[model samples]
Target: MTYRLKYGTGTEAVHDAMPSIESEQLSLALAAACEDPIGATEVYGEDDGVMRTLVTEHAIAVLLVGRITKTVTVLQLSYTG
Candidate 1:
């Protein structure tokens, strides 16, 4: 099932401040996560499947996947570009 994407408290602001290209790249990465949260991202720390990390060319995002809700919440975002 496809998941809904949501940004955590400060994640949206951080994403908004990034360069257009970088932001778009991150957006695409997040879109992929929405389609396949577990398949599109790597485990953040443990093999739990709920906490994940998505890496794009210019950013790394920490995400929390809610299986029951079918949502991918971006908890943190770091721009490297």
Candidate 2:
């Protein structure tokens, strides 16, 4: 189970999983480490890119890191399972 926000796929999922309430939403950033998404992270983004957050119904919070592609067109992401 891996979570990432690169080729817009991850971003789209996370962005569309944010809550309506402002305070209810939680946005976090990722650098060296990563947040696993096996059974955690539900909504993903539940909202627009304005506030990115990985929502989890089980009270787990995760922030996936995004990578830029060589063409600069997509954000490519990979995980070693």
Candidate 3:
């Protein structure tokens, strides 16, 4: 269910790849981060310059859960496999 936003998967640098995470996957990714909000996150305020990690069984993705939109706003993802 977790949509993995792979960074530096290939020869390209992480900065070069345009993350292609979807809505459903975004939700799943967020769910994953929520699993361990305390350990996996270093964010506060819930929005406006906040960030969190969406934890999952096999993968983890970093996203910004915007206060107003309530959606996966940003990505700083990497695969753990």
Candidate 4:
């Protein structure tokens, strides 16, 4: 099943965060993650913790790992070039 996606203020910030060398690497990694997270095998971390990254042409996606009841939800959706 597909997870319901939600956007947080911080996530929104990522959209305008601008592209950097690091973000470029992250973008590619995230795209691979979206295809096969387990197979992607690249780990990314933030101050809070580590989460899976899923990249798309429209956005640089970050998957916050958590549970809301029985459903898996996307805590945020951010964009990059």
Best by TM-score: 1
The model with the greater lDDT, 3 or 4, is 4
Q: Quantify how close model 2 is to the true structure by its C-alpha RMSD in Å.
A: 12.4
TM-score of each: 0.96, 0.21, 0.38, 0.38
In angstroms, how far off is 65's CA in candidate 3?
A: 1.0
Cα lDDT tens digits, model 4, 7-79, are 4557645643757764566555544544445355324565332365555555545566343322222346565
Candidate 3: list runs displaced more than 4 Å. Answer: 1-49
Clashing pairs in 1: none
Clashing pairs in 3: 32-54, 32-55, 33-54, 33-55
Residues 24-65, candidate 1: write the lDDT tens digits. 888988999999998999989998999999999889999999
Q: For residues 1-81, could you state the per-residue lDDT of candidate 3 as single tens digits?
A: 223233333412432343445434544545554443334455543644446655444445555544444344435554443
| Deviating ranges (above 4 Å) for candidate 1 | none
On a 0 to 100 scale, what is the lDDT of residue 24 in model 3? Answer: 43
Runs of candidate 2 with Cα error greater than 4 angstroms are: 1-4, 7-26, 29-34, 42-81
Q: How many backbone clashes can be found in candidate 4?
A: 2
Number of backbone-clashing residue pairs for each candidate, in the order shown: 0, 12, 4, 2
Top lDDT hit: 1
Q: Rate the local accuracy (lDDT) of all candidates.
A: 0.93, 0.31, 0.45, 0.49
Question: C-alpha displacement of 50 in model 3, angstroms?
Answer: 3.1
